[model samples]
Target chain A: MKKINFYILLFVALLSVLGAGCINEQTEDVASNGESGENEVTGTETQIDTIYQFSVIDALLEGVYDGEITCGELKENGDFGLGTFDNLDGEMLELDGVIYQVKADGNVYEVQDTETSPFAAVTFFETDIQDSIKTEMNSQELAAFIEDMLPSQNLMYAVKVTGNFSYMKTRSVAAQEKPYPRLVDVTKDQSVFEFNDTEGTIVGYWMPEFVNGINVPGYHLHFITTDRTAGGHILDYTISSGTIEIDSCDSFYLELPENENYQSTGLSADNEADLEEAEN
Target chain B: MKKINFYILLFVALLSVLGAGCINEQTEDVASNGESGENEVTGTETQIDTIYQFSVIDALLEGVYDGEITCGELKENGDFGLGTFDNLDGEMLELDGVIYQVKADGNVYEVQDTETSPFAAVTFFETDIQDSIKTEMNSQELAAFIEDMLPSQNLMYAVKVTGNFSYMKTRSVAAQEKPYPRLVDVTKDQSVFEFNDTEGTIVGYWMPEFVNGINVPGYHLHFITTDRTAGGHILDYTISSGTIEIDSCDSFYLELPENENYQSTGLSADNEADLEEAEN
Candidate 1:
C-alpha cells in the first residue's frame, strides 16, 4: 500500500510539471518581444495603417545621417514609402514592397535588404481614397487638390500618384563623407534632374503641421519612373494626367535612434527655416 | 490485449488535450491585450520612463471636453501625472498610484477607478536625478534651474518637487455643461486658490517645444499637499526649500482618442497663442 501511494504521488508530480512546461513555452514566446511598438509590427496582426518612421527629420537636418535601421527591418513595418540611404547617399523610394535608390548620378539602383536608412517614413499602403486628375496640375495645385479632398487635414496620409507628367524636377544628394555637413549645406550643391513627359509614380506623405519638428509639416515626396529606372526626391512637377491614391493613417509609431549622433544633436532649436530650404 | 491498447490510446489523447488546454489559456491572456502601447503597460514588465499621454492638448483647446479613457485604464500606464476629469471638470493629479481630483470648489477629492479623462500625460516615476534646494527660488528661477540641468531638452521629464512653499497659487476649472466652450474661454473665469506656508509636492512634466499642439511646450504642473488633501494646477509658486526629482523619459507613446468629438475637432490649426493664454 505504501508503494502504491508513492507511485500515485510521482504520477501527480509528472502531470503538474508537464502542464507548467507547456504554459512556460507559450509565455516565453510573448516575453521575447522587444518593445510594444516593435512587437506590434513583428506580431501576427501586421500593423497596416500606422505611419511607422525610423528617427526624426530633425536628426537628418542635424546631419545625423548614419543609418540605424536596415531596409529589411523597415520593410517589415511598411511596403510603401520614401527616405534617404545611409550616409545620405541618395533619395529612397519604396513602392509595392521594393526599395529603389535614386543616386545623385541620375541612376536608380535596387537596394539590398541589409542596406539602411538614416531617416524614413513608411506604411503598408491601402487606399482609403482613390481619384483621378485628368487635367494638368502643378505641384502646388496637386497638393491643394489633395489637401481639399482629404477627409481631415489633421490625420497623416500616405499618397501615391501615378501618371504622365509634362515636367518633373527632382534632386538627390551625393553620399557624404565623415564629418557630414548639415543637410541645408549639402542641399546647396545637390544634383538636379529634369524629366520631360516622364511617366512615373510619386510616393510621399502629407503630415500635419504638428509634426513640424518631427517630420515635414506638409508633403514630402519621392518619385520613380514607370520602368523603375529613374527617380529622385520630387522638387517640383507638373502632372499632365494622374491617378492619386491616399491612405489615411490615424496611428503613428516613431522609433528614435539612441546613437550618440542622434542624442547629441540640438533638436530643440528651430529648424523650420533650414528644413524648408533643404526640403524645397 | 485489444482492450488494454484502447485504454492506453485514450490516456495519451487525454494528456495531449490537457497540454494544449494549458497553452491556450496562457496565450489568451496576451491575445486579449488591445494594442501594443496598452499591452506594454498591462503586461508583467511595467514600462518605465515612457511619457504616455492620451489625446492631444489641442483637442482640449478645441472644446473636445468628453472623457474617453477611465482613470483605472490610465493608471495602468502611469502612477504620477496630471489632467482633468470628464466634462472638462477640475484638475486631476496622480502620485504614488492614487489619483486626486481638485475641484473649482477649492477642495480635493479622491477619484474612483471608473472616473475618466479626455486628455492627460502620465509616467511611472523612478528618480534619475534627485537634489535638494535650500535657497528660496521663484517659479521662473526654479524652472530655469531645472531646465539648464536636464541632459537634453529633446527628452521628456517627469518632475516632482516636495518641500515648503512660501507662496503657492493654483487654478481649477469648473465642469462644463453641453455645447462646451473652448478651454481658453473656460480658463478666463477659472477659480484661483492661494496658500501661504504650504507644505506640499508639485507633480508635473516638462515636455519639449515640438509637442506644442500635442502637449504643453514647457512645464505643466499640478500640486498636492503633503497631507494629500489640497491641490490644483500650478500657476505660481515660491519654494523656500524643496527636493526636486527628475525622471528623463526618452520614449513617448501617444494614444489619441478616436471619438466623434476628437475626430471632428480641427487639430491642424495654430493653437499656440490660445494655448499660452489658456495654460497660464
Candidate 2:
C-alpha cells in the first residue's frame, strides 16, 4: 500500500511537469509574435511584388511635405523605390537596399533611416522581364521601346536601366522653408545637373494613367552613378547602350498621410498641368 | 514492483498524449488560417477607414467581366460597400454584413458566398460624421450639400443615405454571355427601374480624383429598398427626408485580378468618357 501511494504521487508530479511544458510552449509562441509586432513584419510577412506607396502625388504637388513614415519603414517594405525627402529637399532613389538622396546642391548622399519622406513608391525588385539595348536611343525612344516590352500596360512596373549614357539631364529640389510653394513653382528654381559619357543606372516606375493624381503617370526615373555618388530626377537621358529590367507589380498598397496639412490641403483642384510641369 | 511498473507505463502514455496535444495546437493554428487561402485576411484585419477594392475600373470598362474574388472573400474584408458580380450580372451592395444583388429583373437577391466579383469596393462602416436632411432636396442639391460638408475632398468616403425618396431612378445590367461587350455598350441597353416615394438606402463610395482609373472618380452608388426586395445602381434620387452617414476611408488596398480575361484585357486605354457615360 505504501509503495502504491508513492508511485501515485510520482505520477501526479510527472503529469504536472508535462502540462507545464505545454503551457510554456504556447507562452513562448505568443511572446515571439508580440516581439515581431514592434517590427514592420506581423505574424505574416508583407507580400512580394506589391508596390507600397506613402501619400499621393497630388498631396506632394500641393506641398504637403512632411510625412509620418520613416526611411527605415519604407526600406523594410522594398529595396527599390523613388521619392522626395521631407521639406521637398531633394530627389530620393532606392536601389539595391540603399536609399540615396540627391540634395539641392546636386550632390548625392546616403539617406538616414530616421529621415521621413512626403511621397514615395517602393517594391521588392524582382525582374519579370529583361531587355538589352544594343544601340542608341533617346528618352522618348527608350521609353517607347520599354513600353512595348511590358506584358501589360495596365499594371505598374518598376524599371531599372543600367548602362552607358552619352547625355543625362537631371534636377533636384532644394529643401524648402515655411509657406511652401506649389511643386511646379519649386521645380522652376530646382538645381539642374548634367552628365556626359557617364556609367550609371536609372531607377523609377512606369505608372499607368490612372495613377496620374496618386503618382506621376509616366516614366519618373532617377539616375545614380556607378559609385552611388550622384543622381536626380531624370529629365532626359540619351543612352548609347543599356540593359532594362522591369518588375511587374500586381498589387498596390497606398497609405495616406495623416498629417493635418494633408487633411486641410485642397487636393481636388485639377493639378495635371502643374504636375506635368513639376515632374519634368 | 508490478504496481510500480504499471504506474510507469501509465505515466509515459499520459506524457505522450499531452505532447501530442501541444503539437496539434501549433499545427491546427496554421492549418485553419490557411486551408482557406482563398479567403486570406491581411495582417491588420484591414484598417477601419480603408477602402478595399478588387481590380480596376478600366479593366471593367474594357470588358474584363469575370473575376476571382468570391463574395465570401469580400465579406471578410468589409461589411459595407458596393460592386458588381462576375460576368457583370448585376449590381452588388453590402449593408449590415449582408450582400444583396440587384439583378436585371429588378429583384434583389441574397448573394451566394461562392459568387465571385470582378470589381468591388468595401469598407468596415464606422461613421465619422452624420447629417440630417430635414428639408426636401433633389439629387443635384443633395450631392452638392454632401460635397460641401466633407472635411476634405482628398479622402474617399463610404456614404450611406437611408431615407424616403420622392423619386428614385436606378439601373442594372444583365449577365453577359461569352465575348462580353464593353461597359458603355452594356449600359446602353441596361434595364432601368423607377420607384415613386420609396424607402431605401443609397450605398456606395465617393472616391477621390486620384482613383479615376482604378475606381470611379466620383460617386458610385447602389440602392436597396427597405424590404430588401428591389433596387439597382442609383441613377437619380430626390430625397424627401434622410440621414446621411459618411465613413472617411484614408487607406486603399487595390488587388488586381489574375483571371485570364483580366490578364488579356487591354487596361491602359483611356476609358474615362465611356465610364462617365455608362455610370451616369
Candidate 3:
C-alpha cells in the first residue's frame, strides 16, 4: 500500500512539472509578441512589395469625399494608378509618371503634384507578364480574354493596355463643393465623352473579389490620350490593336483618412449595390 | 527688327531655363519615390500603428480555404483577433494574449503558435477609450449603442466587451477536408451553442464600410468564457453589464498568401451578397 501511494505521488509530480513548463513557454511567447517596438527594431526589414491604397470606398459612398492625400504624396507611392481629385473634381489617370485630370468638359489638364485625391490606388509598375492582342476586341471581350489568360485568380493584377482604339467612350464628373453628395449621386451627373481612332493607354487594376467593399472588384480602367489632351474614366473601348502588361501584386497597404468628416460618417449601410452602380 | 528679334530670343531663353528648373525638380521627385528601399531606410520609422489582415473574405468565398499563415506568425502581429483554422477547422479566438481554438466538439484548445490560418485580422490591443455600459442591451441594441459612442467611423476600432451576459449565442464550424465547399455551403453545417447568464469576454472589430469587400463591415465579435473553456463566433448576446474598450487604428497592412492556391483563385465575382450571408 505504501509503494502504491509513492507511485501515485510520483505521477502527480511529473504532471505538475510538465504543466508548469508549458505555462512558462506560453508566458515567454506572449511577452515576446507584446514587445512590439523592440522586436521590430531588432528584426530585419520586411522585404515584402505592397500595393498602396488611399482612403476607402465606404467613406466615398457616405459623402466623405474630400481629398486627404496630395498628388505629390500619391506619386511618392506609385507611378501608375487611377483616382479622382478632391470633391470628385475629375477623373485622374497617372501614366508614365505624369498625372492627368480628365474633366467633364472633355479636356485633359496636367495636374500639379500639389493636387490631392480623396481616393486612389497606385503601384510602381513592374511588368511580370506581357502579351499582344492580335484580334480586335471590345471592353467586354478584352476583359474576357484577359480573364482566360490570367495566371491566377487570387492575385491582384495591374494591367496597362496601350494601343489605338477604334472607339473609346469615357465619362468624368464635375467637382463638388463642400458637403459633397455621395459618389453615386455625383456620378449621376457625369458627362460622357467619345473619341474616334484615338491612340492612348488604359491604366487600371484587376482587383480580386475579396476586396469588394474596400475597392472596385474586377477590371477598373481609366484612359488618357497619347497627346495628353483628352481622357476620362473608361466606360467602353474597341481595341484595334494593343499590348497588355500585367503586374502581379503580392502585398497590399491601406492608408485611411484622419479628417473629422471621414470619422463621423455612418458606414454601416450595405454599399455594394451603390458601389456597383457608381463604378459600372 | 533686330531689337525685336533679340527680345524674343531672350524671352525664349528665360522660358527654357524655367522649364529646365521644373523638369529637374520633377526628376528628383520621381527618382526619390521610385527607390523604395533607400527611401524607407532613410525615412524615420513610421510611428503609425496599423492593423494587419491576411487573405480576404472573397478568396474564402471562392473556396480558397487553406491556411497560409501560421498561428505563430499571427500572434507575432497581434495578440487580439479572430479567425478560422485550415479547412475551416474551428473558430479561432485570440484574447488576452492567448490563442484559443473552439472546436466543433464544443471544447477550447490552446492552439500551438505553429498552427496556421487562412484568414485573420489582428491588432495589438492598446486601449484608446474605455467606458462602462450601465444599461441592459441585446446584440443589435448594443451594436447601435456602440456605434453612437464611437469616436470616428472612418478609423478601425478593436473592441473588447467584458462582463456578465444575460445570454450569449455562438456558432462554430467543423473542420473541413480538402476540396472544401464555398464558405456559405460550409456555414450551412455549422453548430450553434447558447449560454445562459454567463460571464465572458467578446473579442472583435468594428470595421468601416469602405472595407466591406476586404473585411466584414460593422461589428464582428467572437466570444470566450472567463474560465477559457467555452466560446465561438458570437451570433448574439444580451449584455446585462459590461465594460467596452476600443482601440482606434489609422493604418492597415494586408499580407497576401504566398501559396499557389491563393495565387490561382479567381476573385472577380461580386461577393458582397455571399459575404453578407456568411457573416451575418
Candidate 4:
C-alpha cells in the first residue's frame, strides 16, 4: 500500500509538470500570434482580404512625383489599374495584365517591365455586378448613373466600362524634371486628344468621400483603345453603348513610399480644392 | 582506404540530411508566421501599432447605440480614452486605467467592469511631446493652438491636457430605450452643465481629414476631474493654465464589429453636416 501511494504521488507530479509545459507552450503561441489559441488548436487559417494601393493622392498633390515601384512589381498586385509614370511621363492604363503609357503626343506605348509609376491603384479584376447601358451618355451623366447604380455609398467600387464610344476626349501630361510643381500646375499644361468612334475600355475606381485625401473621391477613369494605338486619361467621353462591371471592395491596403522625397514633403496644406481643380 | 571512403561518403550524406531538415524547419516557421525568412534572420520583432476602435461613428449617428464591447475588454487595449456607454447611457471617461461614467443625474460613477461602450478611441498613453500653456484661451483658440503645436498634419495625435479651467461647459446624453432616434435628434435633449474654477484633465484625439467618415475630423475631447467626480463630453472650456502632452501615432488599426446591426446599417448618406450639428 505504501509503495502504491508513493508511485501515485510521483505520477501526479509528472502529470503536473507536463500540464504546465503544455500551458506555457500554448501561452507563448498565443502571445506571438496576437490571437486566441482556439484557432491554432484547430489549425484554421485566417484569410486576409486586402485591396492593394501603390501610393496616396495626398503625396501626388504634394508634388512627390518620383516613382518608387517598377511596372513589374505593380503587375504582381493587379492586372487592371490607372496612374502616371515617373515624373508624370504619361497617363498609365493597365488592362488584361498589360500596361500602356499614353504620351502627350497622342500615342499609346506598351509599358516596359522596367518602367515605374508614381501613383496607381490596381486590382485583379473581379466583377460582382454587371449591367449594360444602351442609352447615350457623357462622362458626367455616366458618373451620376454609376452612383445611382452603386449598392452602397459607404463602400469603394472598381469600375470597368468596355464598348465603343462615339466621342472620347482625353489628356496626358508631359514628363517633368526634378523639382516638380504641384499636380494642379502640371495639369494646366496637359495635352488633350479627341478620338471619334473609338473602341476601348475605361478602367478606374469610385472612392468614397472619407478616402478623399488618400484617393480621388469620385470617378477616375483612363481610356485604352482595343488596337493599342491611342489612349489617355479620360476627361470627357460620350459612350454610345457599353457594359459596366462593378466590384465592391471591402478591404483597403495603402502602401506609402519609403523614399526621402516622400519623407521630407510637406502635406499639411488642405489639398481638397487643388485636387478638384487638377482632377477636372 | 576503401573503408575510409565509405565512412566519408556516409558522413557527407548525414550532414546533407541535417541541413535539409534545418531548411525545412525554417520554411515551416516562416510560413506559419506569415512573414519573410529575411525578417526572421535579422532578429527584429515588428511592433504592430494599432488604434483599437469600438463601433464606427456613422453607426452612432444612425442611432445604432448598441454596445459590442465591454469596458473591461476596452481596458485591455488602452487606459486613456473617452466615449459613450451603451444606449448613450452617459459620457465615458477612461483615465489612468479606470473607466468613469458621468451620467445625466450629475454624478460620476466608477463604471462596472461589465459596462460597454458604443464608440471609443483609446491608446496606451505615451507622450512624445510635452509643453505648458500659460495664456488663457477658449475652446476654439485652444484647438488652434494645439493644431499649431502638432509636429505633422498627416499623422494622428493623442492629446492630454491637465490643469485648471476657469470655466468649463459639458453635455451628456441621457440613456435611451429601444427604437433609438438619430444622434442629431437625441442631441436636442442633452443635459448641459457648467462649472467654474474646475481642476481636471481633458483626453481626446486629433484625427486627420482623411479619416473624416471613420472618425471625427478634428478634436473629440472629454473632461474628467482629478477627484474622479465630475466630467462629460467637453463642449467648451476656458483654460487658465494647463500642461499639454501629445503622442504622434504613425500606425492606425481599425476594428469593425461583426454584429447584425452593423452589417445591415445604411451608412452612405453624407453625415458630415449631421455630425457637425450633433457634435457642436
What local lDDT does model 4 show for residue A182?
A: 86
DockQ, per-model, please? 0.10, 0.21, 0.29, 0.09
Instruction: Determine which window of 10 residues in candidate 2 chain B has minimal summed lDDT.
Output: B1-10
| lDDT, candidate 3, A134-244, per-residue tens | 888998998977766555666678888889899999999998987778889988999999999999889999977667667777888999888888889988999999899
For residue B105, model 2's alpha carbon misses the true position, in angstroms, by 0.5
State the displacement of the C-alpha of residue A180, model 1, in Å, after optimal TM-score superposition. Answer: 3.4
**Model 1 C-alpha lDDT per residue in residues B113-222, reported as the tens digit of each score:** 89989988887777788888999999999999899878877678899999999999999999999788899999999999999999999999998776777789889999
| By DockQ: ranked, best first | 3, 2, 1, 4
Report the lDDT tens digits of candidate 2 across residue range B1-280.
0011213334443443455455334333322231123322221223455687899888889898895899987875677789999899999998866788999999889978999999998876767888999999998999988888788887888898999999999999999987999899999999999999999899988878877788998789899899998899999989999999888777887888756677666665467789889999
- Tens digit of lDDT per residue, candidate 4, span B1-280? 0001213334443443455455435333322221123221110011112355665677788887888788877765566678898889998887766778999887899887798777887765556788898989899998999998886666677788998999999889999997878899999999998999999999888977666666787898999888878888889999999999886665443445534455446664368889998888
List the RMSD of every prediction in angstroms. Answer: 14.7, 15.5, 17.7, 15.9
Of the candidates shown, which would achieve the greatest DockQ relative to the real structure?
3
Model 1 misplaced regions, further than 4 Å: A1-46, B1-46
Winner on lDDT between 3 and 4 is 3
Q: What is candidate 3's lDDT per residue for B70-129, written digit by digit as tens?
A: 887776566678988988888999775578999988899998778889989876666677
- Residue A34 in model 3: shift from native, Å? 42
Model 3, which residues run further than 4 Å from truth?
A: A1-49, A188-191, A266-280, B1-49, B61-63, B188-193, B196-198, B263-280
Evaluate residue B155 in candidate 3 and report its C-alpha lDDT on the 0 to 100 scale: 82
